[model samples]
Target: MTDHGHNHKHASHKTLTKADAEKALNLVLDSVISAIKSHHNINITGFGSFEIHHRKAREGRNPKTGAKMKIDAYNQPTFRAGRKMKEACN
Candidate 1:
């Protein structure tokens, strides 16, 4: 199959290389992850917000043996789309 610039054209009429796009995406994702690790929330206007959600330890059932189990507490990263993004989707 032939590769293209995801059918997207830059304002300057230049198509971004796949590697470059991947690198850029990686950089952004890494930065967001680092911020979450630091307990900092990221809010990108017109894009979305990234934050961590904490869950307390709780009791759960084991599906395999139908036994009660203790679930450890953990922090989970979450994303909330901005107004602009939501509008764009609809």
Candidate 2:
């Protein structure tokens, strides 16, 4: 396959079709997202961990009007690399 900025290669013996690949990706993402919604952490060995981070409500400003506003509290999804993943990058 031609490089498209990503250098990673699949090590699997079987080839994956575009539709199959997308479906698999969506399944994995949906599972992780659901875990986040339940305030659970999704950890993948040698890859990374995903979790929901809580953010407190805060004051913010509008760029156009320079008016003060309140930013509502929210939960955000975040990821942290595992030790092996970090080491591989270096």
Candidate 3:
């Protein structure tokens, strides 16, 4: 077998710090928030939407002892990927 010169691949990467990651995440959130404010909708092009969604309360079953439980409805933030994004994963 021949070496493909992959020896340096491991040394070339740097780990992102917590602060750096938080900043990056915040940047993405800021952009989305700005888009929502201006356009009333977020358009990630090939990626689906980031929007507000309302969930209705319903009854649910507990696995242990087979008991019925009440589930409260709440508004939730959600993402629905577009066709292109969905197709790419598959």
Give the best candidate by TM-score. 1
TM-score of each: 0.77, 0.72, 0.50
Best lDDT goes to which candidate? 1
lDDT of each: 0.81, 0.79, 0.69
Candidate 1 C-alpha error for residue 70, in Å: 0.3
Residue 81 alpha-carbon offset, candidate 3, angstroms:
1.8
Tens digits of per-residue lDDT for model 2 on 1-90? 543211223224238655555566668879998888899999999999998889999999999999999999999889999999999999
What's the ranking of the predictions by TM-score, best on top?
A: 1, 2, 3
Q: Per-residue CA lDDT of candidate 1, range 1-90, in tens?
A: 122343233312556655665566668879998999999999999999999999999999999999999999999889999999999999
Scored by lDDT, model 2 comes in at 0.79
Give the distance in Å from residue 61's predicted Cα in candidate 2 to where it truly belongs.
1.2
Superior candidate under lDDT, 1 versus 3: 1
Give the C-alpha miss distance for residue 59 in model 3, angstroms. 1.5
Which stretches of candidate 3 lie above 4 Å from their native place? 1-25, 30-41
The CA lDDT at 7 in model 2 is 20
